[model samples]
Structure formats: C-alpha cells, structure tokens
Target: MIEFKNVSKTFTAKEGTVHAVKDVNLTIPDGKIYGIVGYSGAGKSTIIRMLNGLEFPTTGSVTINGSEISSLKGKELREQRLKIGMVFQHFNLLWSRTVLENIEFPLEIAKVAKEERRQKAQKLVALVGLEGRENAYPSELSGGQKQRVGIARALANDPEILLSDEATSALDPQTTDEVLDLLIDINKKLNLTVVVITHEMHVIRKICDHVAVLDAGKIVEQGPVLDVFKNPQQAITKRFVNQETSSASLDDTTVVVSELLEKYPNGLIVRLTFHGDQAKLPIVSEMLRQFPDVDLSIIEGNIHQTQEGALGSLYIQLLSEHHDSLQGALEYFNTMRVETEVIKREQ
Candidate 1:
C-alpha cells in the first residue's frame, strides 16, 4: 500500500518559487490499477517521481509498505528503489545494449548469478512477446517493441510496485491500445500495483479501477473509475469528462435545443437520462403508451456501457395537443427512477 499524507513540493528558481504539488492525501490499495489524470504542468509527474525517491517532498510524508521514503538516503534509498520500478513517456533504452543485455543490467546490479540472469531475462523476453528480438538493438525496433523492452527491463528485479508516467503518450492509437492490454496482462499475472499517469480519458476507462483528477497541483475529484466518469463533480473534472474529438461541441445545451427546434417546430423537447436499473429501452415505449395523446421522437442520444450497467441519454420531442399530460409523463419518469431535464418548449 502507498500513502501520501499532506504531501507538498516547491521548487525555487532564479525568478521565483513554483508550487508544483499541493497538500495531497491519497491511499492507493495494493494490487489494483490506479490512475492519476491531469494536463501538463499539473504536477502529476512530480507525484510519480516521489514514489521512487527521485524527488523529495518539501513537506509532509510519503509512506509505502510501512517505510517512510523521505527519511531514507544514500545506500538505504538505493536499496529501497530496487523494489519499485518505473517506465516513462519515452522508451529510454540504451543504444549500446541489445534487448537481452538491457534486461540483464538490473540483475547484474542486484548481484544475481550470470546464468540466472540470462535465464530470467529469456523468460521475461517471452513474457513480453519479444522472444525473437532479444538480440536486436534499440534503434532497430519499432516504438511498441522498444516499450516492450522497457517493460521487460523494469520487471527484471521483480518489483512489487510499477509506476507508468505517460507510457502511451508517444504511441499511435492502435499501438496505445496494444500496450495497455499488455500492461493489464502483466498486472493480472504478477499482481503488481500499477499507477498510471496520463491525460487521456480512454486510458482510464480502459484499464484503471480507481482514478484521481489533478488540476493546478491538487486533486479536485477522485473515486472508482466508473463512478467518477458517471458523476464528475468539479468544473475541471466535468471538462475532462465531456471532451470530444468530433467537430460539434456538446458543452452547450443550446445546440441540442436549436436542432430540436429546427426539426420539430411544434413539440416539447426534453432530455432524458437513465441510471442503474432504469436504463431499459422499454421506458421510451412505455412513456409513449402512458400518454396516448403524446407523440415522441428520439433525436440525438447514445448509450454508454459503464461498470455498473448501461446508462443512456436521449433527446426526445413530444408532439401532442395536451401539454399537461406531457408534463405529468415527465414526473412519472422521475418517480420511476429515470431522470428528465427540460431543454426547450414549443407551444
């Protein structure tokens, strides 16, 4: 387990002092994938460095498995570092060493026998799906292959904890997914405590069980991955959650309203969301039947598969002569545990 108690860090420069990290308190459970998400300059990198004693905190304490990391120094700190391994945004491979030789470097430092290091390195090469490339130099391999070599080298000492600092940022989308799957496999097989730092939301949704959102050197919101994505609290958290790559922006509800008004000129437009067990598609049909005078049309929506269950959003327009019955129908959905928000009305 890893615990950060009121941890803060500051850097003094010629111009002024920079507060890189605020008073962060977090508890990372053992044998689970934890994610730290933030944009550049959010101090996420500083937090990861503190895990392995690369950077010391200005105040507060960092404890891992009952040992205080800030208190250790010299050979004691170096000895402790062997039990924790880290990977970076870049592959960071030694150009002079072959894949097998690079994997053997850490074992040599730990005083493992020469024959044992070779055998162990060979096994790891097979584990990372690089059995045939063991003799290749770093320059001869692709980006994904080089990262695999880094993974093998980090596991050479059998560290219980693994820290990944934007490990997939340099790879393409397809390559990123492949690397993420490999990390998931490693975590399951070795039960390694993996902490990943990245700004990509897909990374969190893909493999992380728990997550923390950092902004301006402080965690604004955090919890289980599914829960945080479903109900993000802070403005920074909401911005990350609602981000999209499409040409249209969904941040403004007016876009939805304008589209509805352009298509259905004389109807009631409402936004419907379902959480937990109330996310059944039959609710749409049921609402239409209950209010026979009302005509409903689904405009724009999508169903997201969350860890809890299927949650969905629907932009619906109701066409009817009686508006009072339509209003009651909205309340009916509310009583049935489905959520409704009125976007626009056309009388």
Candidate 2:
C-alpha cells in the first residue's frame, strides 16, 4: 500500500518559487490499478516521481508500506527503488540494445549472472508478447513494441509496484489500447500494484479501478472509477468524463436541451443514468408499454463498459398529454434505481 499524507512539493525557479503540488492526501491500495489524471502542469508527474523516490516531497510524507521514502537517502533510497519500477512515456530504450538485452539491463545492474539474466529476460520477453522480436533493437521496433520492451524491463526486477508516467500518450488509439490491455493482464497475473499518471480520460476509463483528478497541483476529486465517471463533482473532472462518454460539453448539452424544449414546448426533457444491470434493462420500452399515452424520443445516448460494469447515459424528451403520466414514469425510474434528472419541465 502507498499513502500520501498531506504531501506537497515546491521548486525554486528563476521566476521564483513554484508550488508543484499542494497538501495532497491519497491512498493507493495494494494489487490494484490506480490512475492520476490531469492536464499539463497539474503536477501528476511530480506525484509519480515522488512515489518511487525520484523526487522528494517538500513537506509531509510519502509512505510505501511502512517506510517514509522522503527520508531515505543514497544506498537506502536506491535499494528501496528496486521495489518500484517505472515505465516512461517516451519508451526509454537503448537503441543499440536488442529487446532481450534491454529487458536484461535491470537484472545486470542487480549483479545477476549472465545465464540467469538471460533466463529472466527471456521469460519477460514471452510475458510481454515480444517472443519473435527478442533480438530486435529499439530502432527497428514500432512505438508500441518499444513500450513493450520498456514494460518488460521494468518487471525484470520483479518489483511489487509499477509506475506508468503517461506511458501511452505517444501511441495511437489502437496501440494505446493494446498496451493498456497488456498492463491489465500483468496486473492480474502478478497481482502487481500499478499507478498510472496520464491526462487522458480514456486511460482511466479503460483499466483503472480508482482515479484521482488533479488541477493546478490540487486534487479536485478522487474515487472509484465508476463513481467518479458517473457522478463527477468538479468542473474539470466533469469535463474529462463528458469528453469520454457524452462526446459533448455541458454547455452543449444545455443548448441542445433548450432547443428541444423550444421545439416541443409541452415536452419533458430528462437525463437518465444507468449502471450495471440497470444499463441492460429495456427501460424505455417498458416505459412506453406502461404509459401508452406518452411518447419518448432519445436525443443522445451512450453506453460503455468499465472495470465495474456497463454504465450509460441518455438524454430524452417525453411527450405526454398528461403531466401525471410523466411523474409516474419518473417514479418508476427512481424505484428501478435509474438516476434521472429533469432537464426541462413545464411550470
């Protein structure tokens, strides 16, 4: 387990002192995939660095298990670092080294015998699906393959924790998904604790079980991935979530809702959120069956799967001759555990 207790970091720049991170408190549980998301200058990279003792905190403590990493120095820090492995965004690999050699680099530094290192590196090569490319140098490999080599190298030490600092930002969407899937597989196979730092919401949505949203060096919100995606509390977090699921901004949603209200003055506009089993239900069909007098039109809807389960949202407008029917429909939704909000209702 990793705990950040009121951790903060500051740097002295030529422009003066800059607070990179502020009184941040976070707990990353063992054997879980956690994400830290933020845009440029949000201090997510700083947090990842602090986790592996690459950067020390200016105040408070960053504790891994029971040890405070900030206080460790020299050999102690280097020894502790072997327990945490890091994967970089740029896929830092030696161009002159082949895949097998790159993966064996860590083992070599650990003073393992040549034959033993080769055995370990070969195993990692198979683990990361680089079997046929073991002899390929970084220059001959694609971006994703390079990252695979990076991952294999990071795991050579058999570290308990892995830190990914924007590890997939440089890849295309398809390649990014592939790398993310590999990470997820490694996590389950080895029960390795993974901490990913990225600005991309898709990364968090794809594999992270938990997430923390940072803005201007402060964590605005943090929670289980499903909870945060379904019900984001901060503006920045909502923006990120909406980008992945809604594909529209909140202002855009409002404008669309307003136009629909103008076109159908008597219609009721609502936003419905469904999760897990609720997402699989034919609620709209059932609503029409029960309320034959009402008509429902979907303005926008999207459903996507997460680590937790399927989560979806729908913007709908209900047309009815009677207001009581609409009220009954909402009550039914409530009882079914479908979260609903009235976007526009007649006074």
Task: Identify the leading candidate in terms of lDDT.
Answer: 2
lDDT of 2 by residue, 57-154 (tens): 99999999999988999999988888888999999898889999999998888889999999999999999999999998899999999999999999
Off by over 4 Å in 2: 247-255, 344-347
The alpha-carbon RMSD values of the candidates against the true structure, listed in the order shown, are 3.4, 1.9
lDDT, candidate 1, 104-178, per-residue tens: 988988899999999999999999999899999999999999899888888999998999999999999899989
Off by over 4 Å in 1: 244-282, 303-347
Cα-based lDDT for every prediction: 0.85, 0.92
List the lowest-lDDT window of 10 residues for candidate 2.
338-347
